[model samples]
Target: MPKSKKRAKAAPASKAAAAQTGLSRRSVLGGGAIGSALVLGGGFWGISSFRTYAAEHDLSRVGDGTLAVVQIHDPQCPTCTALQKQTRRALRALDGCGLTYLVADIKTPEGAAFARRFNAPHVTLLLFDGQGGLHRRVQGLQQAAALEEVFSAHKAALT
Candidate 1:
């Protein structure tokens, strides 16, 4: 019968040298995974943060001679929240349409006064032309497609 030979273990010095090279399989793979996760998480966080920041514009700037879509929003209103989401989706469809989005948050004095100026309530969308003219006022929740069509037409008419 032939005797089988045992595999030789790597020396501790060689192991240290291998780690110092910084190209070992375990180090490469582990570092790559952690790096990838950090990049992905950072991108996601940045996008979400930007969206949240852009969602709320200065209410006082609504009629600042810019074509804008202002939403009379009450945070407690479910319909208002739904309309806000729908508006965002609609804007995506109308990208480059040159319409600034603003929120008339009813919780603030300025927002409340602005809403009262137009006698608009929560869940209302007030479309203003470039000269701050109230071109259209839509109440209640609307579909993204409809909002897109309306926004596109308004954009075309003004420009």
Candidate 2:
């Protein structure tokens, strides 16, 4: 009779070896949750950082020989935040166009007075001529292109 070969059995995993086999499912899930929380927290922080309301002094000073773009808005209003971002982009695009950008918090006393002076409700953009006369009063959020066109028109009218 022919002798049969015996099969070798595999060794079981040791505790240290099993532990070094990379992150477990629970560990990976926990890490992901922590990462997500951190990212979300950072995002909220970033957005909040930009949520500044205009001071009273900011509304009082209007530059001469420049197109004054006064933005009157409430700090807590989402519409105001959206308009603020857009307005910043529009102003940057109109840089060197002899334009002065001003922001006002509608909730402040000075801001309320200014708003009443212009009869603006909220999220208003007031364009002023070089002589500080109201050229255009746009209520609500306006497109950057529209703002640019308005600025150009006012600039032409001023010169």
Candidate 3:
């Protein structure tokens, strides 16, 4: 066999031995990748936090009862449309749970105007109990599964 070929093969074996004895290239690389990702993610989040958007309505209630969602939605808002679909699906999933879903219309200028009077412009989603105790508030659109989990998590207080 050629010396060069033998040396090339031996190189990998030496690396393997080095790994077995102490630190490996794979472990070091993995740690570096994780560290860099964490830093990048933190920086992105920090910058995002500084950007403020228009506030929505507030959903509030009080009670230790069934799962109830009060959504004050404006028909013209893109986010409101998305939440309508998701809320419908979520309510369907929690069928037998005696969940109450309320969709207060805030579609037109008059609707939006009315909603604003009720603090509807500051919030999108709200979960309340029987006694009208405010449990959860979701600013943006929430998925069906996520809504279910929220209710399930508070099942003890529900029933």
Return the top candidate by lDDT.
Answer: 1
Instruction: List candidate 3 segments past 4 Å from native.
Output: 1-67, 107-123
Residue 25 lDDT in model 1?
74
Clashes of each: 0, 0, 16
Give one digit per residue, the lDDT tens place, for model 3 in 85-111.
Answer: 887787678776676666556654644
User: lDDT tens string, model 2, 1-159?
Assistant: 123222222123443454788766688799999999999999998877655433223755564666688888888999988887887787789878877777777778888888888888778888887667887887888788887887788788888
lDDT of 3: 0.67
Which sections of candidate 2 miss by over 4 Å? 1-57
Best-performing candidate as measured by TM-score? 1
**CA RMSD for every model?**
7.8, 10.3, 14.6
lDDT of each: 0.86, 0.76, 0.67
TM-score of each: 0.67, 0.61, 0.48
- The list of candidate 1 runs beyond 4 A from truth reads 1-55
Per-residue lDDT over 1-159 for candidate 1, one digit per residue giving the tens place of the 0 to 100 score: 123222223456667878789668788799999999999999999999887665665765666777899999998999999999999999988886789989998988878999999999899999998778898999999999999998988888887
Q: Kindly indicate the candidate among 1 and 3 with the higher TM-score.
A: 1
